[model samples]
Target chain A: MIKNKTGRIFEIIFYPLVSILIFLIIWDVGVKNSELSVVMPGPWEVVSKFIQSFAVPIGKYTMVYHILYSLMRVVPAYIVGSLAGIILGILMGWYPVINRILRPLYELIRPIPPIAWIPISIVWFGIGEGSKWFLIFLAAFVPITLNAYAGATTVDETLIKCSKMLGASDGQVFKTVVLPYSVPHIFTGLQVGLSTSWATVVAAEMIRSTEGVGWIIISSMDTNNVVQSLVGIMGIGVVGFILAIVMRKIEEVLCRWNRIET
Target chain B: MEQDRNLDIILKCENVSKKFQTKHRTKEVIGNINLEVRKNEFVVLFGPGQCGKTTMLNILSGLEKTTTGKVFLNDREVVEPGPDRGVVFQSISLYPWLTVMGNVEYGPKVRGINKKVRKEKAEYYIELVGLKGFENSYPNQISGGMKQRVGIARAYCNEPDVLFMDEPFSALDAQTRYLMQEEIMRIWEKEKRTVIFVTNNIEEALYLADRIILFTNCPTQIKKEYVIDLPRPRDYTSDDFLKLREEITENMAHTL
Candidate 1:
C-alpha cells in the first residue's frame, strides 16, 4: 500500500506534465500553422510575452503587482463574507425564529446573480475598490451561507440527543456537537466560496482598477492585444487551480476524523 | 433488606405514554408504562423490532418527553436531558470530530471540569472500556464495536446516576457482539452503575438482564417481567437458561 501510494504521488507530477505538454504542443503547432495566428498569436508567442510581462510593464506595473492587487481585493472580502455567512447561516439553521424572519429576504436575494449586482454595487459604493470588494463579497457570501446552513441544520439528530443525554446544555450542544458536526459542511462552503471569489475577480476588477489580472484582460482589450488577454486568463486558471488544492489540503488536515481509514 | 428496598430505587418511570399527532390520526408509541430500577441493577427492556423500545429509553434518559407521566431520578423529576443519565445509543453516536480521549472527556469538559481532573477521569474510563492505547484515535478509524466502547466510555466518564443503552450492541457482528456483552458485563461488575439496557435480541437480554421486562408492540407497555436469578457469567446453553429462554419465547406474543 505504501509503495503504491508513493508511485501514485510520482505519477501525479508525471501525468499532469504529460497532459499539459500535449495541450501546449497542440496549441503551439495549430496556431503557428493556421490562418487564425494573424488574430490569435501562437502559444509560444503568448507564453513568451507572458514571461516578458513579468519584467516589463503591461500597463503601469509588472505582472506580479497585478496579481497582488487582485489578491488584496479578493482576500479581505472573501474572509469577511465567508465568516459572516457562516455565522448567519448557523444562526438561521439553529433558530427557527431567525430562519422564519430572514429566509424570505435571503431567498429573494440569493437567486439574483452576483454579476447582476455590479451595476447596483457601482452605484452604491462608487467605481472604487469598495465596489470591487462588494462584488467579490457577494460572490463569496451566497454559496458559503447555503452550505453552512445545510451543515448546521442537518447535524445528526442522534448526536445532539447523545450530547444532551451526556448533560450538555443548549449552548453546550451547539458548541460541542453542532459546531463540530457542521465542520465538513462549512469547509465545503469555503471551498465553493473561494472559487466563486476567484471567478469574480475579473468582474470585480473590470469595474475600474489600475492593476490586477482582470485589468490585464480588460486593458489588453483596449489595445486589442488578444495574447495579453489570454495570458491574464492563463494566470487566473493556474492560480485558481492552486487555490483549490490548498483548500482541499486544509480540509483534509482539519477533518481527518471524517475520512474513512483504509 | 427492607431499608434497602425502601431507598434503593434509583430511577422510576411513572405512567409514561407518548403519542405523536400528524395531520390525521394520533399514533401512540408508548402506552402507559411504569418501571422502577434499583441501584446498580442491570434491567433489560426486551421487545421486538420497531416496538418503541428506543422511544421508551429516550424518555427514561430524558432525551424525549413523555406525552403523559414523568420520570424521577433520586426523587427529582427529569423534564429534560441532563448529564446525570448517560446514554449509549444503538447507532454509536461518537463525535467524529473528537478523538477517543476528547469524546470521553466531553461531558466533564462541558460541565466546567478542570483539564487535569477530567483527563484523569476520562483515562480511567477509557482503560475500563479496554481502549487504553487508543486515546487519540478517531471514531471512524475504529471498528463498529470499538465505537460503541467509546460511546460507553463517554457516558461513563460523566459518573451519571444511570447508564442507558438503547440496543447498543445490535450493530455489531455476532462475534463482536458476544465479546462486547462480556466486556460490558465485566465493566458493570467492577463499577456497578444502574444500567437500563434496551434490546430486541432475546439472547442479549437474557445474558445481560438481572430482570428482563418483556414489552409489547406499538402502543407499547410491559407484558411480563422475569427476575433471572441466574448465576453471573451465564452459560447460554445451560439447561436452566435454555428452559427460561423457551418459556419467554413461548409466552411472547408476535403480532405481524
Candidate 2:
C-alpha cells in the first residue's frame, strides 16, 4: 500500500506533464504537415497568439482583462448562489415543511439547462450584467442545493443520537452534527457548481458580449478567423482546469479530516 | 423522602418493558425488566445473539422509550437522553470528522463547558484510555480497538453517572478484544463510574463484571444472576474463572 501510494504521488507529478507534451507534439506535427493549414493555423501560431493576447489586444481588451471581466461576472453570482443554495438546502432537508413547500419548485428548475435560461433571463433582467449573472446563478444554484440537501438528508441518525446522549439540544445538534455532516456534500456541490459556472459563462458571453473568451469564439466565426476560435477554446480549457484544481485544493484545506477514507 | 435520597442507587429500572409494533402484531423485545445499579458497579448483561440486549440497554440509557415502564437515573425519571447516561454503541460511532481529542471533548464542549476545563477533562480521559499520542488522529486513522477507546474516552469525558456500553468491543478481533478488555478494566478501576456493559461473550462478561445478569432469548427476561467475586484483572485461565464461564455457558444453553 505504501509503495502504491508513492507511485500515485509520482504519477500526480509527472503524468499530466507527459500527456500534455504528447498532445502538443501531435497537434504541432499534424497541423503543420497538412493541407489543413490553408484554412486553419498551426498549433504554434495559435499558441503564440494566445500568449501574446495577454499583453496585446485581441479586440477591445487584452486577454487578461477579458478574463478579469468573466471572473467578475462569475464570482458574484457563484458566491450569492452558493450561500443561498447551502442555507436553503440544509433548511429544506432538516425541516419537513420547508422541504414540502420548496421541493417542487426546485425540482422543476433543476433539470433545465443554464443556457435555456438565457432568453428568459435576458428578458427579465436585460442584456446587461444582470442576465449573465442570473444564468450563472442558475447554473451554480441547482447542484449546490441538491448536493447540500443530500448531505443534510443522509446525516447518520446514529451520530445524532450519540450527540443527544452526550447532552446536545436540537439547535446544538444542528450546529455540530448536521452542519459538519453536510459539509462534504456542500463541497461536492461547490465543485459541480464551479464547473457549471465556467460552462454557463461561455454561453452567457456568447449571447452578445464584447471582451471574453466566448466572445472570441463568436467574433472569430463572424470574421472567419478559425485560429482565434481555437485560441478561445484553449483559453476556456486551461481556465476550467485551473478552476477545478482550485476548488479541489480549497476542499482539501477545509475538509482535511474528511479527505481520507475511514 | 428519606428513601428517595438514596444517591448510591445510581440507576433504577422499574418494570421497564419495551415492545415494537410490526405490520400486523406487537413484537415484544424486553418483558418487564426490573433492575437497579448502585454507584461504581460494573454490571454485565450477558445474553444470546438476537436477544433484546441492545433494546434493554437503549431503554436503560433513555435512548429508546419503554412501551409500559420507567427508568430512573439518580432518582429522576429518564424520559430523554442526557449527558448523565453516556452510551458507547456496538458499532464504533465516533464522528469520523472529529479527531480523537475533538470527539473526547465533544460532550463537554456541547454542554457549554469552558474550553480550558473541557480540554483538561478530555485530556485526562484520553490518557486514561491510553490514546495519549493519538489525540490529533481521526477515527479513520486508528485501528478498531483504538476507535473503541476513543468512544470510551468520549463517553467518560461527559462525566456521566453511569455509562452504557452495548458490545463496544465485539467488532474487534480476538487478540484486540482481549487487549481492550484489559484496557477497559484498568480504566474502570481508575475512573470508578457505574457501567452497564452488554455482550454475548461469556469470557468477556466473566472477565469484567462485578455481577453478571444472564438474560433469556426473545422477549427477554433475567434468567439468572451471578456475583463475580474474583479479584481485579481476573485471570481468564484461572480455575474459578473457567468454572463460572462453564456454568454460565451451560445455564445459557439450557435457557436458550
Model 1 regions more than 4 Å off? A1-8, A32-34, A260-262, B1-7, B254-256
Task: Find the candidate with the highest DockQ and give its number.
Answer: 1
How good is the docking of model 2, by CAPRI class? medium
Question: Candidate 1 on B113-214: residue-level lDDT in tens?
Answer: 999999999999999999999999988888898999999999999999999998898888999999999999999988888999998888888999889999
Question: Of the candidates shown, which would achieve the greatest lDDT relative to the real structure?
Answer: 2
Instruction: List per-model TM-scores for chain B.
Output: 0.96, 0.96
Pairs clashing within candidate 1: A167-B83
CA lDDT scores, all candidates in order: 0.89, 0.91
Model 2 residue B235 lDDT?
A: 97
What proportion of the true contacts does each candidate reproduce?
Answer: 0.84, 0.86
Model 1 has an lDDT value of 0.89
The regions of model 2 sitting more than 4 angstroms off are A1-13, A32-40, B1-7
